[model samples]
Target: MYYNILRGGINLKKENITFLDVLTLFIGCFLMSLSLNMFFNPHSVAPGGITGFAIIVNSMTGIPLWVINLTLNIPLFILAYKILSKKDCVKTILGIIFLTLTLKYTIGLSEIHVTDDVLLASISGSILMGVGLGFIFRINGTTGGTDLLGLILNRFFPSLSVPILMGSADCIVVILSGIVTKEIEIGLYSAISLYIIVKISDIIIEGFNNSKSFTIISDKYKEISSSILEELDRGATILKGEGVYTGNKKNVLLVIVSRRQVVTLKKLVKEIDPNCFIIITSINEALGNGFKSIE
Candidate 1:
């Protein structure tokens, strides 16, 4: 079924998955499994989503975590194959298989048990898992489960955003943890873990190379734009605008600057035009000079 979908949707015959891609996926799976088996499962820290569900099920039924993980991901994988690209489905399948195998072999190893403290366990486990997951996602692959659901939501509702959907799903899974464990603390820790994982995943994926977009609405457009160019060494675009209330013609300055240069740019704008309306926002992935490259 997946094969037919792949043939129809993706140009797989022309674009082959590289060895480096496979290697990265394998390493990502290993890191994820190691984090789960050593840090999370041993400490009963749920990191949300299907992995959390697997942990709860394994706790109750004494079933292998890998088995539960595989079962939980299969349906999602099928859905991904139908709704998303076949290449995505194939990469997710590889990721799940690799993670399952890694977990099976490493489960019996001396559990790291990094910290007996539940809070510490939750934080640390979430960080490692989040970083590993981020690497997989960066390579256009997934660890399967609810991550696929997040992708699906992002595709169908372009305006809804991935973070919002991810948070909603994780919150539901964390709430379910409380019911399965019959403890309020379990739910709390699950929430903490989910938060840490999302935050750390964002950090890992975005890295320190963050950029910001600055929009300035000011009467002193020339002075502000000139100062920005001379001091910040960044280019600015002048957008023609009109104030609705006053019906006054205005030139808005739009610029993209690195995170490090944001304060400098803002100060320059403030000095040039005290009443300038300045708005700055983080750009997840910017492509161009002074930013990220798309290809």
Candidate 2:
């Protein structure tokens, strides 16, 4: 009975955490804090989440970012601990401590003056924060913020969903930042930065192994499946599906292929059956014979 929360979307088994885990957490927290001070905090660009809100507070009041993180995260952690298992709270606790310490130590980075342009600041900061969060999430931990708040709120309102709640909170905070700062551009730029953060973090977590998946419905399922296996050198699974309108049973062929083989697949299916129904989707990552083997 453990509750594991990943900021992006990674689920690591709850087992004995080694030194590597600690090192990874430290590095992640350090990078996030560094980005905050060097880029986001300096230029009044709150990306998203509790830290983003803290950035807004810092811009309004002269409060230190680390203090705000420490102040806000403590109560959230205490409240959330009521539901989250002790085993699950271990990395969360470490994540919070490491992030707080790093933010405090990196406080001087703000005055270091890395870049004057806000656009450059947003991109660089987003990249660093994304990478940092990716590493932290990969280990089944979070640095206590709206992420924990989202899960806690989900307990009361099960229908809302954690991601939706988290997203709503972040959007509100980002909008508030823009209004408070008296610049509409702030919100727009922050939104862009947030988008970049999510994308980069997804790439970091899932990897750049973009693959294609096909859901094929055709009378020539046998030929299509065979062609996929032999010519495309791929695997195809025959699935039993019933037509929603007709209530007739149908043979569905599921195929996975690399990006390079997408055109070949379309051509092959067309040559075999010109009127075949094909639905192609881009997959983030796929593991197996033709893809990366499970390590």
Candidate 3:
């Protein structure tokens, strides 16, 4: 009985600490820390969300950024715990802890003057911060700020999408920039920073080597499948699908290929069977060979 209980407990723990989850948290925290210390702090640019609040509070009170970051994140974390899953809350906590520690230890060492140019700082900081946030989100965790607001919106209004909610939250922050800093330049830089960060984060999390999922209803199934494997060096899975209207049996060829190879694959299918019904969609992250590695 004791041995069984111990084994069960070990398995339970193992289930919690997945390799992908850990990697996501580590990368997310690292990017966020780097962006904060290197770009945002040096220029005193607020990029929005909890970090923005932290920066504003830090500037006004002279408290360390890390302390402000921790205090600001706690209520957001609690909101996340209540609205989101327990696992998400735990992962976010771990990410926040790592971010705080990195900021506390490394902020002093990072270059305080990357560039005197405000535009450069705003752009670079936004990109780095967005990429970091994206990585965290990819693993179904958030850094606790506007993310909590996003979650609350998602929970209460399931129809409203994340992007819409995020936009709404960030817009409020941008408007609040006027109150934080008197100069209009600060607000402009803040807006620029937010834009850069969001776009970059989307790209990073989606990855450069994205894949397209193609569903082709072609008479030349064998030819198309063989060509995909031989020419594209990609794999195809065939599903037995039936036409709803005609009640006719159809051979549906499903294949995933990189963005670079998508045009080629489409052309090949067209050449093989002009009448082929093809549907192509984007797969944000594909793991394994020719894709994102979970590890």
- Identify the superior model by lDDT, candidate 2 or candidate 3: 2
Candidate structures ordered by TM-score, highest first: 2, 1, 3
Report the C-alpha lDDT of model 1 over 1-295, residue by residue, as the tens digit: 1134344554434346566776888887888787778777776667787778788787779788899999878877776666665567667777888999998988884255567787877777788788888888778887787777877778888898877887788788788777878888988988888888878878877776778999899988998888887898888899999999999998998999987888888787777778889888888767877666765
Per-residue alpha-carbon lDDT of candidate 2 for residues 1-295, written as tens digits (9 for 90 to 100): 3325444322434456667887998999999998999999999999889899999999989899989998999889888986776546777778888999999998999998898988899999999999999988877778999988998899999999899999999899889878989999888879988999898888888889899999999989999888888897888999999999999999999998999999999999999999988999999999978789874
Best by TM-score: 2
Pick the winner on TM-score between candidates 1 and 2.
2
Most accurate candidate by lDDT: 2
| Tens digit of per-residue lDDT, candidate 3, span 89-110 | 5666777787788778877745
lDDT of 2: 0.88
lDDT of each: 0.79, 0.88, 0.78
Which stretches of candidate 2 lie above 4 Å from their native place? 1-15, 155-159, 241-249
Give the 10-residue window scoring lowest on summed lDDT in candidate 2. Answer: 1-10
**By lDDT, highest first, what's the ranking?**
2, 1, 3
Clashes of each: 0, 0, 1
